[model samples]
Target: MKDNAKISSAVIKRLPRYRRYLSDLQKKNVDRISSNELSNLIGYTASQIRQDLNNFGGFGQQGYGYNIQSLYNEISSILGLDKDYKMVIVGTGNLGQAIANYTHYYKSGFMVSAMFDVNPKLIGLRINDIEVLDYERLEEFMQDNSVDIGIVCTNKDSAQEVVDKLCAGGVRGIWNFAPTDLQLPEGVALENVHLSDSLHSLAYYINRNSQMKDQD
Candidate 1:
């Protein structure tokens, strides 16, 4: 096992991308891949890919490059994707619902164990076969369940508060969907996803292309 303290978070994040590409290569029966090939597929420079991979240890040879199967197993184990992770989601809104309906999580080694909300009407309802529990029961539920991660889909105004509660409830990792930047205490891992920002960027690109066509 690699020392968690020694590995940089940036390298940890890139491990997933590496795993996905390696998995794709595995499906195609690709026996080996060079760092340059990985760089081209993932949009990183060849030197950058080599540096990231070398940080963990030299997995590739000087001329033969990396064995696809060996690299896939290595990255998967490093990222903790070799084992199943228990996860829960807070908030039962549209975004939360969409996530609940997503089947890809199971395929990726994460299982959504529970869903939560403060709404009386939503509590006890089922989303993707997981019962929607009242937020008041969060702490108790965490005690009974082996939840390793929490996903926060609450609004921006309530995001920080929800995160605080989750932390207090013993959640060490969080996937925050709310727009607000959260201040977390030490030993907690928080990943923020800004959907609106991605949409805005997409819109900007489309508008820029349209304007260029109009000029031409």
Candidate 2:
């Protein structure tokens, strides 16, 4: 650990992109890649890649560049993917069920062992081959199963309560998909997924490009 306490959030945020791109390269049989090559593939400048990787000790060689598999493993280890993580979803709605069905997360070392819902119909149902449990048992389930991450797919109204219960049950990470902001404790890692915000940015860029074209 290279004193991650000092690493900027922006740098930390790019690790997943690096891992995903490296996996893509591996699938294409790319063995080694220089920073400039990687930059072209991922749209990040070579200097940006160097700086981001340098935060955790760069893996690039002086002239040999980087070995794709080795670099992927390095980034995976940094992202805590070397160890299997048990996950539980707090809601079994469409969003929650979609997340449960997302198999790529499993390939990335996260296992969705269980799901929860308050609706009587959703409870006891199986999604993605995992049995849905009653939300009432969430706290006990967490205590017994050693959940590493809690995926909060609840509505915005219930998001905080879900997070509180999950954290209280010893979950160290929360991937919140609700449409609101949340506050986490000192050591807990929080990844807030605001879907509409990205769409809003897309619309803004489209409008801006249209205006630029009008001027041209």
Candidate 3:
């Protein structure tokens, strides 16, 4: 595989979509696929798909195209989905609990090892058998467990503090769902899901489409 840092973020972002399509193809027992066939399924031009995949190396043959299972496995490995990751969630509110349940039911390689919350009623509860401990115990828990990811679902005011504690405890990555932006030290990976921003983007597209129709 080529150096990931040398690859553009746009290409990297598209990898998950490629993997998803490949996984669906695998479910249908499609053994081989030409770039053109994959393009039709994924809505990317064949040339674009070929170029994006070439960053990781030549995955498809000239005429034989790609072996579906092999390509699927390779993409899974590339996305680091082949490995198991243990995570802890800070905040046991609706969103946090929903994420916990979703990962537990659907994501086989990711485990929610613990949950923390400031609410006493929420504390001591178990979601999918993972106990919700006190927020105050978070630093201590982090000191003991080898957590790979920290999920922040708290309010924006508390998100940074929770993330700081998680980072101090040695989490290598953070999945942030708080509404505000956060800063992390060098080396720790951060992924943010800003719900309001996404909704705003959707509204912008909706308004643009309405205006275009009006013009017509």
Candidate 4:
């Protein structure tokens, strides 16, 4: 197995794509898949596929390609899908509700245990079977429950306050979906998810491609 030090983040990021496609293959009852076959589905070259997995260790056989189930398990284990993670969303706004409703991550090790919101209407309501607890009780609720990750889906005005409370409550990992850039203490893992930023990135590439075509 490849240690964290020896692996590249790009390789780690692609591991999810591998696991996702492998999972699809499992559902189709496909037992084994050659590198070229897998490459066609995932849009990666066969050699690139082999190189990526080689970073982690032996996965493919000489003549046979790879056992679909075995490769899925290996990639899943590498991505820490073998463990359980509890998450709490600190807002019940549109984005938070959408995430709670749409994401099936709960079925795959990362379960969203609770949701919090300041709006009186949203508090005590259930979205996607998970009850929205009042923000007033956040500290008490956190003290009683085990939250491994905190999702900040609040507005810019209230996002930092919610994050600070999560930090004070000893929560380690945070997924911020707010517009504000959050500052967290050292040792706390933070992932700032700016949907607008991603859209802008897409716009940039699209605009660039259009300009190139015009010049051509």
- Measured by lDDT, the strongest candidate is 3
Residues 8-118 of candidate 1 have per-residue lDDT tens digits of 888888888888898899999999989888888999898988888887778999999899999898887777778987888999888898887884344677888889999
Model 3 regions lying over 4 Å from their true place:
none
> lDDT of all predictions, in order shown?
0.86, 0.90, 0.94, 0.89
The Cα RMSD in angstroms, rounded to one decimal, for candidate 2 relative to the true structure is 1.6
Clashes of each: 0, 0, 0, 0
Q: How close is each model in CA RMSD to the real structure? A: 2.6, 1.6, 0.8, 2.0
| Regions of candidate 2 where Cα sits further than 4 Å from its true position | 104-106
Per-prediction TM-score, please? 0.87, 0.94, 0.98, 0.90
Q: Which candidate do you rate higher for TM-score, 1 or 3?
A: 3
lDDT by residue (tens digit), candidate 2, 18-100:
89999999999999999999999999999999988988886999899999999999988888889998889998889888888
Instruction: Give the range of the ten consecutive residues with the poorest summed lDDT in model 4.
Output: 101-110
Among all windows of 10 consecutive residues in model 3, the one with the lowest summed lDDT is 70-79
* Winner on lDDT (3 vs 4): 3
Positional deviation of residue 45's Cα in model 2 after best superposition, in angstroms: 1.2
- Arrange candidates, best TM-score first: 3, 2, 4, 1
lDDT score at residue 107, model 3, on the 0-100 scale = 73
Candidate 1 accuracy as lDDT = 0.86
**Best-to-worst ranking by lDDT:** 3, 2, 4, 1
